[model samples]
Target: MFKPLKGLLVLDFSQFLSGPSAALRLADMGARVIKVERPDGGDLCRRLYISNLELDGDSTLFHSINRNKESVSTNLKDPADLQFVRKLIEKADVMIQNFRPGVMEKIGLSYVTVKEWNPLLVYGTITGYGQNGPWKNKPGQDLLVQSLSGLAWLNGDADQPPVPFGLAVADMMAGGHLVQGILACLVRRGITGQGGLVEVSLLESTLDFQFEVLTTHLNDGGKAPQRSSVNSAHAYLGAPYGIYETKDGFISLAMGSVTELGELLACGPLAAYADPASWFAERDEIKAHLRDHLKQGNTAHWLGILEPAGYWCSDVLTWQRLLEHEAFKELQMTQHVKRDNGAELITTRCPIRIDGEIYQSAIGSPKIGEHNDKIKQEFGGVVRE
Candidate 1:
């Protein structure tokens, strides 16, 4: 089947997560993505520690996000290899790189240089900060962006120190934002036949995620919400909301608002607190009563009882439980990719669906310089693929 980005050439010069992830998205949408790496061990993800699965030297994490692409290792310092890169740039429609601020400029593959070779090239760049910021030269990591953007301060309990988020939120956000920028630029180019530089910064991406907080603070005369524990998210009132411990496991019960509390109270043991307004003055006693009632059964029991009764409740599932969940199967959120070694692993596919089908590509990540011969043949001036 024809895909939206078919026949487009993408030169992927990024490594690790952000740049590679955006390239992978384009590749999955049917673009020809050529990943460039250094001769000394390519992407750091190749050596990332993965304890759960056996790997052939490279980590499964590397393969998980880098499918549907070709890889080439070139020594940019060498004049011959630099010429080869110039040749590839001549034919590429899009170029993606996530390096420290000026690395591309230093390598002579900057937007100014590449556009000279191909004026219609869409150069997408991802950085720690932006091109002209004070923090642009400094190393930026996910944790650093999270901390600097106030994510850590907004997380965790009020009494505890700022807690770090478990996920690489900043990197993922920057990658997704980069994809948006690239696609927008592609549209602009299609309309005007002009290609321009597309830039995404990790720091800006992290701050964008906190738009709700920032917008609220601006709109509400600088009234920032206090950092509260996850359990106390809706407990300011007498409503029974939070993660409740059951006999065997835990369940999230959010019986917030008078109406929701009334609904929960109708379910037998909780029925005594049906009149929330009367117990509004005795909130501590009412919450204690609900907490004591919740401890009588397991998570499954509580979910079965409350979830069906219109109380927004759910079981707190482990990662294993989530993967094996019927919901995952029904949603088709994961896919299996067979490797060159004839082994297969389950990995996430694109979140977007087209024509009721989730688009996927079978091409696994390339070995370091796996496509050197192919790229060399195509762009060597004397030979072509």
Candidate 2:
């Protein structure tokens, strides 16, 4: 369906979330991605489990990120395997790896070495930190990066200890950044007829994710962010910008005039906050009043009053309620894919839409080295004895 990367080929040598996720995006755009893995055990993410769930003996996490891609197992340390991989590199339009700084160089597959084989190849790399930093060798785990980047300090109530995001935000952000860099380089390659190196680190990407608030801290006398003492959703935002409990459920509110919100909710104490500066200065008192007032009515009752008035508000929803809602159904965001062995998985389709057409595939992730025979036949590469 008008896939822009229809004829491109990608060799993904990365394991786990960050690098594999980048390859997944490329595959979604119609690139032919071949995962180059070790013959034994393959990607370590195959065993990285969440909730102890497994599909076809691989972690569901691995299956979710590796779909619509092929697999070719090779041991880079072996001369024969390394030679065959070099041949593949010579033919690939793009290559991705997430090994720590010097791992690829030691394996003789570094960008400096591979660029000589395929001049127009886009080489992408993801590291825990930038290559020259002291943190470069540190593990690039999601939580560690989150904690190190000060992102954890921005969540939860101010009284509570630092809270990390429930999801692997750092890995996902780095992956997305890598994709953006790779795509931009591809565009430039079309003009210059030369490939380029794209590098992203989990620490750097996570820092970029906090650019807005961090920018504020940098410019505003270097003052530390002051999170709301109650219902703190954002550290730098003012009153009425957090979720509140209702009689039956919860609702969230965004930025708006405090007096207008107080008038609408009939919370008279809020009239004192008519001056906008008081919203931030006395956010706890303002939010405490909102908290007590909102809990008196059901979530729907509060929504009914605020929605018609054009205030930015919503009823907080759980996954069950959201999936059942017609709005979610209209998006058609989920799809079913199956492995060759008939193992089926229900997962999300690509979020990107090209020319108003949603991209989807029925192919699931492959077994380690699943495409070895087919690849050897198609590419005519033989291992030197």
Candidate 3:
């Protein structure tokens, strides 16, 4: 496959998720990402297990996020190792770091310092809040940032306490935002022949993530979002915008007309509230009615009716059902990745397609410092072998 970023090099100084995820995207697009790790333990994520699951002597979490990348161990505190890493940075096209503010500056790898050595390198930084805020020095964990940014309040029912997403959405979103900034910097560098620093915070990214609802909350008075008391799916959406229980399973409905949905489902009670304004105002009552009405049919039965009529609805699927479905099977999302140590794993590949072909790398993540020799020889850095 044609790789757009084939010749580009990225030196990833980030650990855990946020910064490493940005490097993962660059690697997915075919950049050579060399993870800079400490000689002692490398990324902390190696042992940061989300569950009891383990793969290749490290947590599956580490392998999944760091896949298709190289690793070069270095101790930034040591002068020799720091100079060695500086050599790699002098040649890298992009550098990503997620350490708390002033950590990189403590070392000599700050954007200002690095820009002196390499004028065209893009420096990307991810932080908890931002440079000067009181929260700047705090930990950038996903859940904490979500709570601080008011994202947790958007999920679950109205009466329930603030509920965070099941996944690390804050970190992932910050990674995406960093990638956008880095990509923009790269484009600017192409024209101006100068590098720039791109900074994003989990707080800012989480805020941007909910720009739609937050904007509504800001403009439509300082009122907090009121989630549906019954079958809540969206904080802003009205009735029929939630998961409904089926006889055997569950189905979700996106934004659509209440009257049209009522007419299609033959629910007389729902059809009575025909006013569009009531969709937002009477969301709970309508949702309660929908919850009762939908329970009479199975998921497939409702999909058969709703899908044919062009109402935005789908059967809520579990991971087991999703993997077994032909629609997912046709996408060919999964790949078998093997490491040089005879370790193998089944994981999803990059979601991007180029020239009608899905670009997937069979290369699994490296063992700590696995590529040290190869990268050191190729880059002609310090005498460290």
Candidate 4:
């Protein structure tokens, strides 16, 4: 495959998800990513388990995000190791860090300080809140950010307490935003021979993720979002826009004419809601009808009626069913990556196709400081004895 970032060098100073995820994307696109870590235990993410499952003495989370990368363990507090890292930084094209505000500054690796070392380096930073704020020092965890950014309010039923997403959406969004910013800065550098700083925060990214609904809130008299009392999918969208229980399973419905849906499903109660405004005004009632009517038929029965008409609908599927389906198999979304000792992991590949080519690598994540000797030889950096 043609790799656009094949020659670029990325220094991943971030741990956990956000910063490392950005670097992972860059690595997928062909950049050489080297993870800088503390010599004692390396990235804290090595032990951050999503489940009891672990591989090669590290959590699966670490392997999933840090694949296709190198690791160089260095204690930043040590003068020799710090100087050695500075040498690596001077040669790095891009560097990513997600330490809280003042952490990097105290270590003399802040963007302002490092930009002077490598004038053409793209410095990307992710914080919980931002550089200077009352919440700047707050823990930058995904769940905390989701709650503070009001993202939790957008989920679950209205009667229930605020529900955070099951995934680390805040971290993922911040990581994606950081990648965009870094790429934009790289493009600018290509044109003007100048590198710049790119900053993204979990809070800001989470807010931007809700820009569509938030825009509605901002314009529509600042009214809080009204989640449907039944089968709620989107807090802003109208009826039949949620997952409905079926006799056998479940089906998801997107935006469509209520009357048309009712006619298609042979649901007589839905025929009462013809006006578009009533979709929102009487959404709960319409959804209640839909919820009851849908439950009378199997998922396939409803899908057979809805899909042919091109109404946005689908059968809800579990991971096992989805993975076993031919449709999923055709995507070829998963790959096997192996560590040096032949321990293998079956994980999803980068969900990007460039010019009709899918990218996959067999190399797994490295042990802490695994590439120290090789990097020291190639980069010609010396650490004091």
Candidate 5:
């Protein structure tokens, strides 16, 4: 209802996750995002599959992230199309790209070049690493950044092999960071009448995401994190901060006093370790007690016991369970977007609320170059170089 970015223009020149995700957020807030893609294949993410699922000949991922946006397919190598796209960039309020370090510079669309073209444009960029580092060009992909940024070391048990996050944590984190920086730049431009470069790297974002634990490790003698041998949830957390198997299902435990938990669950052995430091020093031992005690009952049974007593806990839920729950249904997080051809997609809606109104877009992702003519007519530029 209250579209804050109603008249703003965003030019998304990136592919795959990071750059597109930032554009997606802007589009959610009602920015008119025009995705600039190669004429042949368009965005690579159109086929970058997380699963075998396809919608309207594009992957589910593409539909999910690129919805509520226009597409303008162009051959960047063609001087005519390149000049037209540069004109669009000159008119844009914001621009985003996740190209490798030198690619944009080679094409003359780097931050410096674009800032000169339109001093009011907020240029958002993503890289695998920083601009001038040894690993700058070493693939900006998420999994590689996760492994390289010491992120995999934080997951799973200490005895287990390094476990990377199942999701594209590095890409999404970088995208979020890009959005933050871009919003800050937008604010600066609003006041100063000039825009600034907002750059984020997958490596930088991944490392920043781990700052909480990394800071602790740094202060605590630079020792590496020691994940629990069993029910490992957080690398730095103490006892019971994990998911434990129950008679019927699993339940997760958040931070809470072990003495109160022992009293609530009738875990007799837990009373001995009353001190708070033992929660970490003897974490595994206490978790072992919780593991055994929790397994005696079903997830609901444990939840019933711990919830009323104010102990932080939860039943681990699958997608079906979460979808069926009333609490989740109240959030109204999903939306269905249908194409003119009757093809439809059900995807997550924007997480932000402006003035208590949810941002829901009726527009689905476009068929490649879908808005080419309409946009060319409305934008009224495209002179050939």
Candidate 6:
């Protein structure tokens, strides 16, 4: 339907989440993305799970993130294959890779080389840290970035040790930032008929997540936020912002003002702490009030009572429950698509909506070297022998 990136070509030299996921966004917008993998096991995610059941040729985890693209398996170390890749890069409008610092230069496929071939190409580089920094060469994982960025410190009960968040927040955030940078470069190219290199690092992205906390601490004379264990509110905004157990399940509630808190307490045992402004004035009193009321019922009872009271609340749903959630259904987030192998499985469509339609791309993740011959013929005007 009015796909803006219809004529754009993307060369995806990235693997794993940060880079590949960023390329996935371009693919979603209708760019012709060619995912380059190795002749061996391919993306490391191909061997991630210890699953004894092999449903597809590759691991499902690999398939999940590699959908809507052509897979070309070539050993970049080989001169002939490297030449083929260089030709592809010359024609690409965008090039994305997530190798460690200096790795791209060592391989001779750095942005500088691609820019020599196509000056208008948008080169995107994703890394664990910025191109050069004290920690640039140090290997980084999601967990390490979380801790380095102070997010881990913000998590968990005050008394317990800092716990890492389950979601890959650093990688995901970096991917989003990478996309924004790429789009900006694309826009600039449209105006000047020239492209520039765009870079995003997990460490840099993680720090952005702490903007609110960092800004507050900076203005507050460098006093870091304390890890509070009590049920009391931590921010200047008053209490009633946390997960509470009800009769059947758990629900999250966040009421910032005295009015919203009064509406929430009117539902269940929370009525005792109805006076939000005065209730949290003393830290000890706030904790005691929350413990006494929230423990009265389970999550379901709390949701049924508090949700209708105009309180911002939701059930803490497991994946299965979330799959069946009405909001997900209304949003059309998940879909079932058949792969080339004739098996159907669930996959996620792009989250963004362009106009009235939910963004759709080619269904199913590609098989290894799935379109190698076709791509070789199209790019070089002759298929590889």
Reference-based TM-score of each model: 0.88, 0.99, 0.97, 0.98, 0.97, 0.90
Task: Tell me the tens digit of each residue's lDDT in model 1 across 61-123.
Answer: 788878878888887787877888889899999999998987888999999888889988999
Error of 1 at 342 (Å): 2.6
What is the per-residue lDDT of model 2 for residues 1-385, given as tens digits with 9 covering 90 to 100?
A: 6699999999999999999999999999999999999988999999999868899999999999999999998889998788889889999999999999999999999999999999999999999988987888999899999999999989989899999999999999999999999999999999999999999999999999999999999999999999899999998899999999999999999999999999999999999988999999999999999999999999999899999999999989999999999999999999998899999999999999999999999999999999998888877665322
Give the per-residue lDDT of model 6 (tens digit) for 285-306.
4544555666677777766666
Instruction: Itemize residue pairs with steric clashes in candidate 4.
Output: none
Please name the candidate that would achieve the greatest lDDT relative to the true structure: 2
In model 1, what are the clashing residue pairs, if there are any? 265-271
Q: What is residue 4's positional error in candidate 1, in angstroms? A: 1.1
Winner on TM-score (5 vs 6): 5
lDDT per residue (tens digit) for residues 1-385 in model 5: 6588889999999999889999999999989999988877889999989999999899999998899998887777777787887789889999999888889888878888888889999999899998987898798888899999899977888789889998999999999999999999999899999999998899999999999998999999988788899878888889879989999999999999999899998999999989999999999999898888888988888889889988888888999999999999999999998666889999999999988998898789987888888878876655221
lDDT of 4 by residue, 77-172 (tens): 888889899999999999999998999999999999999999999999999999987998889999998998888988887788888899999999
- Model 1 Cα shift for residue 127 (angstroms): 0.7
Choose 1 or 6, whichever is better by lDDT: 1
Colliding residue pairs in candidate 3 = none
- How high is the lDDT of residue 160 in model 4? 80
Question: To one decimal, what is the Cα RMSD in angstroms of model 1 from the true structure?
Answer: 3.6
Give lDDT tens digits, candidate 3, residues 1-385.
6698889999999999989889998999989999988878889999899999988899888888899999998878888888888788889899999999899889888888998889889999999999986777888899999899999988899899999999999999999999999999998998999889999999999999999999999998899888888888888887778888989999999999999999998888987788999998999889888889888988888899989999999888899999999999999999988788878889888888888888788888888888888887887665333
Error of 5 at 215 (Å): 0.9
* Preferred candidate (TM-score higher): 2 or 6: 2
lDDT of 6 at 126: 87
> Candidate 6, overall lDDT?
0.77
User: What TM-score would candidate 6 get against the native?
Assistant: 0.90
User: What local lDDT does model 3 show for residue 365?
Assistant: 82
lDDT of 1 at 294: 69
| lDDT score of residue 377 within candidate 2 | 80
Between prediction 4 and prediction 6, the one with superior lDDT is: 4
For model 3, the local distance difference test gives 0.89
Q: How many backbone clashes does candidate 5 have?
A: 0
